[model samples]
Target: MGVVNVTPDSFSDGGHWFDTTAAIKHGLGLEAEGADLVDVGGESTRPGASRVDEAEELRRVIPVVRGLASEGVTVSVDTMRARVAEQAVAVGAALVNDVSGGLADPDMVPVVAAAGVPFVVMHWRGFSESMNSRAVYGDVVTEVVEELRARMEAVIDGGVSPEKLVIDPGLGFAKNGVQDLALLAGLPRLGELGRPLLVAASRKRFLGHVLAGEGTPPPPARERDAATAAVSALSAHAGAWAVRVHAVRPTADAVRVARAVEGAA
Candidate 1:
């Protein structure tokens, strides 16, 4: 999956694709670069980010989704709002990639269950505003697996079909650098949950943290693409269903190499 964050304050691109046209072009470019699907989100979910009003989210997202879908590109709406998911589906979104995993909105599960589209049930501790405070865990990997297991159950109980679910570890959402690294190392445990895993280690803080190697400022977001591609390679080799990333070309190439290696193995 390729990322197209259509918000002015997204940590990755910081509004590079905020305009509807720019977002559509970026999505198409991802498709051209070999992305299996393009994920378009309007709200910025980085740590300390606040929610944009529902109207603003819809206005930012719908047109881009519509534009991409019209161009025959598969599109996923990365939103937590039921109304936005519903409207995006109406306008041509093929999947609902909710970061909240249906926890943010009561209407979200029903909307997705009723729409019958695939739902990405991410491991979310809380809303982005307070999520950093909720990263506490006894054993980060085990806790994340257990939490995601319960969320999968809850989503199923809410009437979504079992066959229509995907799971994400939600790197950097509530996790610190060490916790995120532990989760990556624990991918097999997460995969044991028995749903396809979506690894979103794009230009996240942890990558910058590792690249900085202490006593230094982390590189800017765009500068982390090579690191992101490295993670993409490992994640793919470890059985991730997809890696959601901003720089599609390098990851696309990286995953292809991983697949070739897997095939040889």
Candidate 2:
């Protein structure tokens, strides 16, 4: 999966693709770079970010999603709103990648089920503005897995087929650096849930901290792509079904290398 943030404040490459034409071009570029799917998000869910109104979000993403799908690209609408997912799928989006895992909107599961498209149910505690405060965990990995399991049950009960579900650990949604690392290390445990796993750690703040060392300022988001690629390689080796990344080429190469190594082994 490749990320195309259509909002102006997504923490990484946000303003760069805020324009409709630019966003479509970027999605096409990601497709050319070997992304299996291009995920277009209209809202900025970065820590401390405020929410965009439903109207604006719909305006921002629909054109991009329609444009990409019209061009024969596999597109996924990255939104928590059932209405947006419904419209996007009607216009040809192949999937719905909801960061809220149907927790934000009561209609999301039914929308997905009716559309008959694949859905990505990500682990999220709350909306972006207050999510940081909800980061507390006894054992981050175990807690995340348990929470995701509960979400899976809710979505399944809501009429979405289990086979159409994909789970994402949501690296920075409500997690501190340590918790993020723990989740990455615990990928196999997440896989035990019997759903395909999506690792979305592309250029996240935790990787910047890991690269910065103690007491140093972390590098900017764009500079963290190489580190993201490294994580992509490791996550693929650990059995991740897909990786959502801003820069797709390096990670695409990394996944190939990891696959080759595993096949040889």
Candidate 3:
């Protein structure tokens, strides 16, 4: 999966793909870069990010999804709003990538269940505005795994088939640097949730922190491509079902290489 944020405040690529034409171009470019699917978001869920109205979110996303679908691209709508998910699916989104994981909107579970397409549920606490305060965890990995398991049960009870769901560890959301590292180290426990795990650590702040090491300034987003590829390989080896990345071609290449080596072994 590739990341395409059509918002002006996405932490990394804000304002880069806010225009429809530019967003479409970026989506197409991701396709050309070997993305199996492109995950597009109209709202920025970066820490402390403000919410956008429903109409604006729909306006920013639907057209891009339609255009990408027209080109036979697999499109996923990265939204927590049920209304946006319904409209985007109607237009051509094949997946609902909800970072809020059904917590933000009361109607999201039912809408996703009715759609019957793949739903990517990220582990989240409250809305973006307050999630940072919810990051406290006794053991980050175990706690995240437990939280995701609870979410899975809720989603199943809400009528979404377990088979149609995928889980995301939600790398930077509601996590401190130490917590993020612990989660990565314990990803296998997350995989035990009986759902495909989507690790979205590409160009994330945690990766920058890891690379920074000794108080050096973190690498910029564009410069994190190689680091992202390394994380892709790590996640895949740790049994991740997919990785969401900004630079798809390199990560795809890394995944292919890892798979090839695994097969040969």
Candidate 4:
């Protein structure tokens, strides 16, 4: 999956695509760079980020989603709102990538079920504004897996078919560097949940920290693409179904190489 943030404050490449034309171009570029799907989000869910009202989000995203779909691109609406998901699907979005995993909006599951589109249920503790405070965990990987399982059950009970579900461990959401590393290392445990996994560690802070060494300032988001690609290679080797990324080419190449190596093995 490729990310196209239509908001102005996403941690990475936010305002770059805030314009509908720019966003559509970026989405098309991602597809050309071998992204299987493009995920378009209107809200900025970065740490300490405030929420955008539904109306503003709709205004920012609908045009971009519609334009990309019209160009025959496979589009996923990255929204937690049932209404936005519904509208995006109507405009030809093939999937719903809800970061909240149906927690933020009560109507999300039913809407997804009715549309019969694939839904990405991420491990989420709270909204972005307060999520950092909720990062405490006994065993981060185990807790994330258990939480995701509970979310899966809830969505299934709400009428979404289990087969239509994909699980994301949510790398930076409510996770510190150590917890993030633990989750990545524990991908097999997460896979035991018996669902496809989506690894979205593209240009995240954890990767930056690793690249920076101790007591050094982490590199900026765009400069972390190489590290992101490295994670993509590892994640694909470990059996991730997809890696959501901002810079699609390197990850696209990395996953292919990983697949080739695995095939040879």
| Candidate 3 per-residue C-alpha lDDT over 1-265 given as tens digits, one digit per residue, 9 for 90 to 100 | 9999999999889999999999999999999989989999999988898999999999999999999999999999999999999999998999999998998899999999999989888989877788789899988888888888899899999999999999998888999878887888898999888899999988888888888889699988778888899989989999998899999989999989998999999
Candidate 1's error at 106, in angstroms? 0.3
Q: Give the 10-residue window scoring lowest on summed lDDT in candidate 4.
A: 253-262
Local distance difference test, per candidate? 0.94, 0.95, 0.91, 0.94
For model 2, residues 62-176, the per-residue Cα lDDT tens digits are 9999999999999999999999999999898999999999989999999999988999999999999899999999999999999999999999998999999999999998999
**Model 4 Cα shift for residue 158 (angstroms):** 0.1
Better of 1 and 4 by lDDT: 4
Q: Is candidate 1 or candidate 2 better by lDDT?
A: 2
* Model 2: number of backbone collisions: 0
| Over 4 Å off, model 4 | none
* TM-score head-to-head 1 vs 3, winner: 1
Structural similarity to truth (TM-score) of each candidate? 0.98, 0.99, 0.97, 0.99
lDDT (10s digit) by residue, model 4, range 159-241: 99999999999999999998999999999999999999999999999999999998999999999999999999999878899
lDDT of 4 at 84: 95
Tens digit of per-residue lDDT, candidate 1, span 115-215: 99999999998987899999899999999999999999999999999999999999998999999999999998998989899999999999999999969
